[model samples]
Target: MSHSVVVGIDGSAQSRAAAEWAATEACRSGRRLRLVHVGAAENGTRAQPESAEDCLPPSVLSVRDRIAAALPGLELSCVRMGGSPPYALAAAGEREGLLVLGSRGLGGFTGMLVGSVGLHVAAHALCPVVLVRADPDGGAGAAGDVVVGVDGDRLGDEVLAFAFEQAACRGATLRAVESRALPTGPYVTRAPLDQCEIRDSLAEAELVRLQDALACWHDKFPEVRVETEITAHPAGRALVEASRAASLVVVGRRTPALRAAVHRLGTVAHAVLHHAHSPVAVVPHD
Candidate 1:
């Protein structure tokens, strides 16, 4: 099935960046773009109109106009809804396809890596979501490459395919991070890392295991350039840290309990969504 992209706009500089990215994606994929703007946050009551300036938020309207003008050839439609940004975006994406949002909005703190709305959509959106965060001057396009985190588990196969597809579409490099651990404590108490990884260290046996696991992907997408990194640390922290220079960080959610836990307590995926300097892409492993 084909997929269109729905973008959340608020006229914030960050939102504009997101819209631009979405427009680019839409144009490239020959898909449609839906621009959705949520009304000003209030006490669930409509605001009385005083002047034209106060009637609508400038950032919201400005982004709407800019995206419309920028992608005149693409199928673009705009919406002005009254509610929270995440809710509006989620509803819009329910039919169109993927949901896209900025890393931060006008209400966001300058120091925060990701905004509240981004966190909400990334956690709850029914479809895949992309959180855009790049300098307005266009540093994002040049950030170069998509980095995806994976453990040598059942989930890695699907995640590997998704990451490779995204990278191929974006003309970007793909980096797969297989996270393991190091034996730090005594051997008596040494055990598995809570079913996360079966063993510790990236020894010869571990490399062979990982290579064997990746044989399918290697055969399927032989032309797609990929780099593999075997990390010895916690998965969440390592992936989030790697997102600093990455254009997008891809992570997969597996199992119902794991999904709920990630959404609630911020798993490796959510932590990357909230803390990554770049945008994050969370995909389901099912």
Candidate 2:
């Protein structure tokens, strides 16, 4: 199987982290690493802006060189193009490559927040997009686990399967979480439960259902150590909180079937990408 990991870098510490993460992944997978930094020209217009000819920041190039040097055997290349990071990265992803990027950039102020590039790429990229957050604790160890959330959606299997493979490769534990929460719309019955006790009972039933679903996966991946968690909050929030201990958080993207009635991302997925303490993998629905 052929694979390539393309990372977006802007020369800041945050982007440097993203580059390092991407390079490490490439080395592990024995895939080439394409380190891309969007200069002003390759952005939206596609026209080479005269003034932006030498715009690729020297700091960014230096960072890329250092990372490439650190990883002697890794194949790394840095490109300076004009355009937005998200669009450029997405275009690269369309060729069936993984796109990795930092959640923020050089201006420490904005780096504290998830930038539009990370969000846009996560939502629209064709291949899996890994959005790395700035973590003071540094990167995951060889034994760190890759945790994933599953909800039986189109992309659920993709996320779980990918995480399983990654965990196996890294010799890390594999954990899966399924959330139990009432859907936004009411159940089939129009009759409302008048008593609070009745509502509480229904909630309990839902929790049991979620457990059953998780148990099914446990039976399937018996060799892959699995730990399950249940929470009552929104799916995204629950997953984001859990991400603190995870090396990577994996979630399914919106499938075509659900796109008509809803946007690709719900509130939770958005929150997870913006606030997750670890890197997030947005896997497209298969």
Give the top-scoring candidate (TM-score).
1
CA lDDT of each candidate?
0.70, 0.70
Candidate 1 lDDT tens digits, 233-282: 67778887788767788887653545445443237776777677677776
Model 2: per-residue Cα lDDT over 1-286, one tens digit each: 3467888888766677788888888888889988777765433345342233244567776877788689878877767655666677788766646888887865446434577677778877767888776567654322256778767333366667678767766766777676765554433554665555565667677656655665655566666676665566777877878877778888878656644444366566787877777888888764
Q: What is the lDDT of residue 103 in candidate 1?
A: 84
Clash count, predicted structure 2: 7
State model 2's lDDT.
Answer: 0.70
Candidate 2's C-alpha runs over 4 A off are 41-55, 106-112, 137-143, 152-155, 181-223, 257-263
RMSD of 2: 6.0
- Clashes within 3 Å, all models in order: 3, 7
